[model samples]
Target chain A: MKKSIDAKKGKGPKAKLSNDQLLTLYRNLVRADHFDKCYVRRIQAGQLISFYHAGEGGLAPGVGACSFLRKEDILWPHHRAHAQGHMLSKGIDLKYYLAEHTGKTTGCCKGRSSYHWSFPEYGVFGTSGCIGAGFSPTVGWGLACKKNGDGQITMMCCGDGGSNRGTAHESFLMANNWKLPIVYLIENNGLAIFSKHEDMHPTKDIADLAKGYGMPAVIVDGQDVIAVAEATLKAVEHARAGKGPYLIEAKTVRIQAHGVGLPDLVDYTPRSKEEIDELRERDAILICRERLLTEGLLSQELIDQIEAEATQEVADAERFADESPVADQLDLSDINKLVYAE
Target chain B: MREITLIEAIREAYIEEMQVDEKVFLVGQDIRGGNFPNTTGLVEMFGDDRVLDTPISETAMVGSAFGAAQMGYRPVVDFMSGGFAYVAACEVLLQSAQHYFQHGGNVSVPLVITAGVGAGLKLANEHSVTPHAMFLHHPGIKVAFPSTPYDAKGLMKSAIRDNNPVCMFWHLALMMEKGQVPEEEYLVPLGVADVKREGTDVTVVATGLQVKHALEVAANLESEVSVEVVDLRSMEPLDYEAISRSLEKTNRLVVVDEDTERCGFAAELIAQVVDKSFDLLDAPIERICIDNMPIPGGYLEAHVLPNPAKIETAIRRVIA
Candidate 1:
C-alpha cells in the first residue's frame, strides 16, 4: 500500500508564496543554472582541474529546497552538483566559493578541501565522501537544535542511491524518537550514478521510509521551482514548529552525466542524440525560463539581463580564482599546522 | 586516596564531568537503563534529554554526538564493546576526525568515545577485540587505553575536556581491577608515559591489559633481569620521549601487546624505537603478542593471548 502524504493533494499545509518570493525563487534557479554552466565550461576548457558532479538539469531542487531557509538553519548538502546550488542559495560567498573550488587560498576551506565545501558561518558543516554518512551528523545537528531550545532546524538531502543505506533508516527512527527539528530532503534524480530508479529501488517513493517512522512526508515536482519551494516552506514550518522531522522527495532529472570529463552514459549505453534532447527538454532551468516567460513575470529584457549578469559574475569569479594564490602548506616549519585546531 | 574499581572510576569521571559542565552528557544504547553499570543512575542525575538512550544505532549514536559537540555541547559516548565500533566506521573514523581539518578548523568536535575492548571472559569474535590500533591509524583521532583505575579516571577526564575527538578504549578485562584514586581532581595528560617499574637490564613497553602482564613478569624476573616497565596509556600523541629515555638506560626492548602480532601496534612500536635508537639496542628486540588469528573462546583463548608467561619469555629472549 502507498503511504506517502502527497504535497500536491492538499492534505497538508500548502505554500502560498508572495509575488516577490516567487520572483526571488526564479532568480535563484537562474543563478544556480548559471553557476553549473560556468563550472562545466571551466572543466571542459581545461582551465580547472577538479572532480565535479555536473548538476545542470538538477539545480532547481536544491535551489528551491533552500529558498525559504534562513542563514541560521543548517543545510547538509548532497554530493549531487557538489551542492553548489544549495550552498549558493544558502549564502556561501561566491568569489571565495569559486576560488576554493579552483584550489585557491581565498577559498572557504582555504583550498584545503577542493570539493568538500563547508561554511559553518552559513550553517553548512562539511559533507562526507561516503554517501549515506550525512544522515547521522545531520541528526546530531537536529539534536543540538532541540537541546538548545532554539528554533533552528537542520535540512539535509541525499541522492536516491544513498537513501537505501542503513544510516538513513537509523537516523530517521532516532530523529522521530527524540522529536528533533530536521527536514530530511531527498533529491530523487532517479539515477544512482547510471542505475535507473526502477531497477535500483522498490516502491518508487523513498519518502515511504518517513511514513514508516510515523512522520509526515511529501513528493513534489522538482523541476518546478515554485512547487519545490512551496513544499519546502510548509515542511520547514512543520519542523520549526517542533513537529519533529518532515521528508520531501523532489522528483528531478539529471540531464548531464554524473561527473564532468566522463562520457554521458545511461544504462551502460551512450545517451542517443534524441534521448539527450528529450532530457534537455526536461531541464529545470529551461523549464523555469519558459514558465516565467509564459507567466509574464519576467520580460525578455529582464531574462537577458539576468543571464548577462550571471555570465559576468561567473567570468569575474573565474578570474578571481585564476589570479588567487594556491594555499600555502607551511606554517613556521610545521607542515601540518592546520591539521589540528588549538 | 581511596581504592575504587576501574568501572567505578569511570562512573566517577562521568558524574564529576556532568556536575562540572551543564553541556556534558552521555549517549548510547541502553544508557538510561544503566545496562553497562558505568552509566547506571546517570539518567536519574542528568535526566532523559541529556542521558540519551537510543535504539541499537551505532553510527547515528556517534553522529548525534558529533552534531551536538559541534553545537558546543560536550558528549561522552560508550560503544558497549570495541568490536562493535566497526558498525559506525564512517561516522567514527571519517566524519569525527576529518570534519575539523576539512572545514578549515571552524568546528570543534569535543567528544570522548569509549568502548569496553580487549579479549577475556570468552566474549568470542564479535565482542572480544581491541580497536586502539584502528583509531591510531587515523591521524586526527586520539587513542588511549587506561590499564588502571586511577589512569581510567584521570585520562577520561582529560579526554572529555580536550577539544578534539578522542577514542579512550578501556580493557573489558580490567573493569573490576582496583587501584587508589584521589578524592581531589587530577588528570593524566595524553601523550605521556608512566614507568610502572624501574630496572636497568631491559625495558618493556606495553598498553592496556598487557601493562599488567609486563609488570608481573618484571616482578617475577627481578632476581635475574632487572626489567623496566613502561605503560603507554595513550597511542596517538604517544610519549616517544619517555620510551627513548627508558631505552637510554635499558639497551634491550621487548613489547607485549594483546592485539594481533602481524602488522600490529607491537610491530609499529619496535620499528619506531629501533629507528630512533639503533645504537641503544645491545640485543635484537622481541614482541609478545597474539599470533595472527581470530581469538578463540574459552580456554583456547589463553594460548594466543599475551600472558605473564609470554612477557617473561620475550624479556629473556631479548636480554639473551
Candidate 2:
C-alpha cells in the first residue's frame, strides 16, 4: 500500500526557501534515501560486500546544511550516512563514489579507502575511520583558510557518539580560543550505536556544551529543512565574519540499524510495529513531501518524477561500478612503493 | 665554517626553511614564547601567524599538524620531549602514519616532528626516554637521530623539504653541544649513514647520544682494539649497505642503543646483521643498552643509560 502525503491542518512555518531551492533539496533527500535502499538490497543479494549505514531520517539536515557551503569552503565529515548525502550534494561524482565502494582502480582513493575517502578538489577534505578524529583537523583547515586570507569557512560534522570524545572538547577549546572560521554541526540522532543520548550524556542538549567553550550554539529540528538551513546560514555568517566557531545541534532520528541488517547481532531500535510506524511517519522525506504538496509548490507527479530520476542515477552508478576495473594485485616490491611519497 | 650548538643549528634550519617556503609553519605549545630554546626568537622573526603556540593538548596539536599537512601545508610540530609522544600516539600512529597508504597514496603528509630524548637532566621517566624504536617500527614515517650540530641542521633541512612525514629526535644532553657547521646551505640526505671513526677490528653501531659515546670509546681503545663507530643518523631507512661494508672489514659487531635491550633497536640491528652477514662474523656480537627498567630521576639515570665505559666494555667483549 502506498502511503499518502497528508498535509498538516494549519499553515506551517513560513517557507524560508524558494520554490526551486525547495525542489532541489527535496530531490537530494530522495536521492540519498534511494541510494541507501539500493545499498541494502545489493548487500543482501551478495552483490556488494561493504559496511553500510542508512541515513534515512537525517537527510534534511545533511542536505540543508551542506547546500550553503561554497566551493572554497571545506567539509570534514563522519563515517556514516549524512556524509554521503553531504558529498553527493557538493557535486562529488556518484560514479566514482560507487566505484570506490566496489574497490575499483578508478574510485576516489583508487580502491584504497573503503569508507574514509577524500575529494579535496570539491573541498571534502576527508573522513576518518576513527570517530571524532577529524575534529582537530577541521580546526587546522580553518586556520589554513584564515592564514591564506581566503575568507572560507570549514563545516565539520559529528554524531552524538563522537561529540562525547575528548578530541571534540579539545577542538572546541582551540577553535574558540583561536576564533577560527569553523561551524561544528552535531547531527544528534538520539543514539550512538546502541545507547541513547540520555544514557550516554548528562546534558539535555548537546549544544549546551558550547556555552562552556565560549562559543555561540543553537538547537534545530533536524526534520525541518528550512530550520536547518536558517541555523546553518547564521552559523556560516558568524564564522565568515571572524567571530569564531559556532555549534549547531540538529535533533534527528536514526530509523535503521547502525549498519546493514546486523540486527541479529545487536539491535537497539524500537521493536514494536506501532513504534516503528510512528518513527516512519517522522521520516524527513515524507515530511518534506507533505510540506511541498500543502504549500502548492510541487505535485505528486513531480515528486514521483524526481524520485524516479534519483533511482535511475543510482542504477547508472551501480552499473558504472560493476563494469569498472578492480585494483591490480600488489607485489612484494609494491609494499615499499607507498610508504614514503619521495 | 661557524661553530654553533645543536639547538642553534635546528633554529637556523627552521628560519631558513620558513624564509624559503611560505607554506612552512611552526605549531606547538610555547613555540611563540620560545619555551624550548630551539624555537626561541622564531616568533619574533616569523610573526604570530607563521609561528603558532598551541594549548597543552598534545593530541589536538599533533592532529592539527596532520590536518594542515593534508591541506597542502608543511607543519613542523615540537613535542618538547620524546616522552610526550605517548600522549599523542594515536595521532602519530593512526592518523599521520596511516594517511599516505590509507588514501591509496593520493596524499602526502609533509610534517616534521621534533622532540628531545635521552636521560641526563634528572627529569625522570616521563620527560626523558629514547622512543625512536617505537617510531622506527612504524612503516610510513622517516626517523632521524642526529648526534652532531652539522647533521642536526642538515637533516632538519632535509626533513622540511621531503614530501613525507619525518620525526627528528634530539638528545636533551646534546642540545648545547657545540660543533662546526657550514655557513652555506647544505642538507645531509636521509637514509645515509656517516662513519664518525673508522677501524678494522670491531664495528660499534649507535644512534643519537650513543654515537658520541661510541666515538669516544673507539678513540680510547685504539691500542687494544680498532673500533669503528657507525652513526646511524636515520633509523627507518637504516644504512644497511654501510653496516655490511663495516661488517666485512671488522668481522665483529657491537650495537649500542638508549632504548631497552629487549626487542629494541639493538636487537633488530643484531638480527639483521646475523641474517645478512652471519658467515662474516668472527665471534658473537655484543650489545650495550639500558636494561628492562624505567629510567628513574637523579644519579640512577646515569647508571641505567649507556655511557663510554659501557660502549668500551662491549667493544672489548666483542673483540675478545
Scored by TM-score, the top model is 1
lDDT of 2 by residue, B1-320 (tens): 67999999999999999999999999888988787788998888989888888888887788767877878899999998888988888788767877787777777888998898888898998888888888888888899999999999999999999888899999998999999999999999999999999999999899888999888877787887888899989987788999999999999998999898888999999999889999999999999888889989998888888889988887778777
True interface contacts reproduced, per candidate: 0.77, 0.61
In model 1, what are the clashing residue pairs, if there are any?
none
User: Could you tell me how far off, in angstroms, the CA of residue A11 lies in candidate 2 after the best superposition?
Assistant: 23
Which consecutive 10 residues in model 1 chain B have the weakest lDDT in total? B131-140
Best candidate (score: DockQ):
1
In order of appearance, the predictions have TM-scores of 0.97, 0.95
Q: How close is candidate 1 to the true structure, as a TM-score?
A: 0.97
Interface RMSD of 2: 1.4
RMSD for each of the candidates: 2.0, 4.5
Worst 10 residues of 2 chain A by lDDT: A1-10
**Candidate 1 ranges beyond 4 A from true positions:** A1-10, A290-296, A328-336
Over B203-299, each residue of candidate 1 has an lDDT whose tens digit, in order, gives 9999999899888888888899999999999987789999989999998999888788887888889899878889989999999888799998887
Global Cα lDDT for candidate 2: 0.82
